[model samples]
Every structure is written in structure tokens, then in C-alpha cells.
Target: MNPPTSTWWTWLAVAALGTFHGINPAMGWLFAVALGLYRHSRRVVLLSLIPIALGHALAAGSMLIAGLSLGLVIDHSWLNRICGTLLLSWAAWHALRGHRMRPRVGMQTGFVGLAIWSFAMAASHGAGLMLIPALMPICSALPGAGGAAGAAGPTALIAAIALCVHSAAMLLTTGVISLAVFDRFGVSGLRTKWLNFDLLWTGTLAACGLVQLAL
Candidate 1:
């Protein structure tokens, strides 16, 4: 189904957000590498991507549910401003603290650990925050947008598609990067890169957040 006419802008925003997420240093391929190191098994390393993708999907799905339940409308510029402000605040905090973030890969390296780590990583970084506001206008503008609880079928479908597309892109991009790093530098090099770039990634997030606020 086509997105509501009035929500085109929202869709574009969400798509852009997805692209941004793909490029974000903090959320990039590094986590995959960390998982590889933790497991010390190439098979497990490859499998870890599954949980990370699922976790991201869950976070985005949760946001979509919240928007639908609240009858959230994104027509208001003020709400965008509020979201922007929040992002900026988060960025400033990271900047001030220099973001001593570390990958907490456990020894167990089981599915449970992978899932928990994936969820924690996504939530901590506000993975789906951009998608929420971006889809709000589209969902609210659809026909029978708020007519009944079940009226959100079309919008929900669109959201599912969007989330899938975004998550797939993330997995592919991250997976490739992880494999490349493992092939070239080995686990030691990957770990060293993660350690060195932690602050840089934090700064990048903070900068993006602030820029969103200003825009």
C-alpha cells in the first residue's frame, strides 16, 4: 500500500534516518566484531548478527506501537523540535563524558547473551528514535488513521516494511565490515580499533544529535 500523501515527508525522513543509522559509527559494524572476539568461533560470530538485527527490529516495533496507541501526529513542528532537543541533550551528555563505552561481550556467548547484548546496545543508543517521529505523520495522515484500533493496518504494514529494510541494510553492512576486519587485522586489531574509536563514535553521535536539534 502507498503511504498517505501527506506523510511523504515523514517517509523520507525515516528513510534518511535509516541511512544515517547505517553510517553511524557507534552503531556500525564494530559490534559484530566484538561478538566475534567474544565467541572465538566464526560460526557463532556470524550467528550473532541475527540477534542484533532482531533486537533493532524489536526497538523500532516498540516505537511504532507507542505512536499508534497514542494517536501520535507528526504535523506539529513543536514535537519535532522536542525530539531534536532530546537528541541534542543526549549528544551533549556523551560529549561531556567522552563516552567510555565498551562492548560487554560475556564469556558464555550463547543466544541469550547475544539477544540481551543486542537489546541493550540498541536501547542504549536510541536506535529507533528517529524512525518514530519520521513515521508519525504518515500513520496519522492515512485514511481512517484513528478511526479504530484496527484501522492502522496499512500504516503498520508500511512500518514493518521500513523496519525490515533498515534492519537488513544494517546487518549486511555490519556483517561485511566485521568479516573484513577479522580477515585483515585479526581479533586483536578489531579490539584495538574498537577501543580507540569509542570516543570518536560517541562524538559523532553527539554531533548528529545536536545537528538534528538545530535543524
Candidate 2:
């Protein structure tokens, strides 16, 4: 059977958000480009994405799992409000003190360090929190979603698939941008041609909160 319309939209929203995340330099592509330049190896840039993606999946997956658990006890409407409030608060915090939360990593950092940096960056940015709104309908659609005896297994499987889909989109976007910048533009141009997405990021976060509340 064809999936429901809401399911399609939820998947699309997850992917669209992933693409946005990949576009944001603070997400990891810029760091990947820098690392590639530092090591003077395109291969290094490609390899770095693995850890970055892994760290992001872990960070976002943690939130998904938490939300799934909470969905069992909390009403869907209340959950939405909770996530919306949190998203708004997070946006405000990001606007006010996000810079202080960004983890500093040197070019000489190893794979593990890069993963840790990505995790810290994603967590601070509330990347996973952004997924909750999309995740709600997904989990809610499953059989016995609210504390059902047999629902946990399918819910987890579906959540894993959703996370993979989102992460894949993010990885692909990040790889494209990273390679393009490293191959054609080089990082030097950033000094003169950087597009600051901080405001856009803040705005998007607020928008996501609004969406959650509206839903």
C-alpha cells in the first residue's frame, strides 16, 4: 500500500532539514574542507565525513530515542508543545550564546576528535531537537504507538530508517559542498566571501518551533 500523505511530508521535511544542515558551515563541511586542506588530501576530506556523519547520527538519534520513550507516556499534543517550547528556548540560547558553545578543534585532530567535535556541535545547535516534530507523526503512525507491547520494535526500526535517510541527505550535501569548495574555490575566498548563516539558522529554528506548535 502507498504510504499516507503525512508520511511522505514527514520524510521530505527530514530530508530538507538535512540539506539545510549540510549547507550550514557550522554543521561540518567547512571543517571537513579545512581538514582536507591541512592534510593536503582530498581523500582526507572524504574520510572525515564518516566520523562527522556518525557523530551527528548519534546526537540526533539520542534525541529521537528519548522522544520515542516519552511519546509512550505523554500525550502527542503535550509532546508537541514541549518540543516547541524547547525549540524556541534553544533558538534564543543559540542567538545569545551559541558561539560560546561551539567546540574548537585543531586541524591536527584525529578521527575520534572530529567525531566528538561534531557531536558537541550538533548537540549545542539542537539539531536533533529539530527532528522531533517530523518524528512525531512517524512514531504516531506505527501500530500501538503509545506504549504498545509490540510496537517498540517497529518504532525503532522506522526511526532508524528515518535517521539514516536524514543522515544520508546531510552527508551527500556536505560532501558536494566540501569537494566543490576544496576543488574550485579554496578556503581563502571565505575571508572575503563568507555568507553568515547565523541569522538564517536562528530564524529556521524559530520557524520549526512554530511548526511544532501549530501541528
lDDT of each model, Cα atoms only?
0.61, 0.86
Which is the leading candidate under lDDT? 2
**RMSD in angstroms between candidate 1 and the native structure over all alpha carbons:** 4.2
* Model 1 poorest 10 in a row by lDDT: 67-76
lDDT of 1: 0.61
Estimated TM-score for each candidate: 0.71, 0.93
TM-score of 2: 0.93
The residue-level lDDT of candidate 2 at 148 comes to: 51
Clashing pairs in 1: none
Clashes of each: 0, 0
Q: On residues 34-121, what C-alpha lDDT tens digit does candidate 2 reach at each position? A: 9999999999999999999999888988987887777777778898999999999999999999977778899999999999999888
Q: Single out the weakest 10-residue window by summed lDDT for candidate 2.
A: 1-10
Model 1 misplaced regions, further than 4 Å? 4-28, 37-40, 67-75, 97-103, 144-151, 187-215
lDDT of 2: 0.86
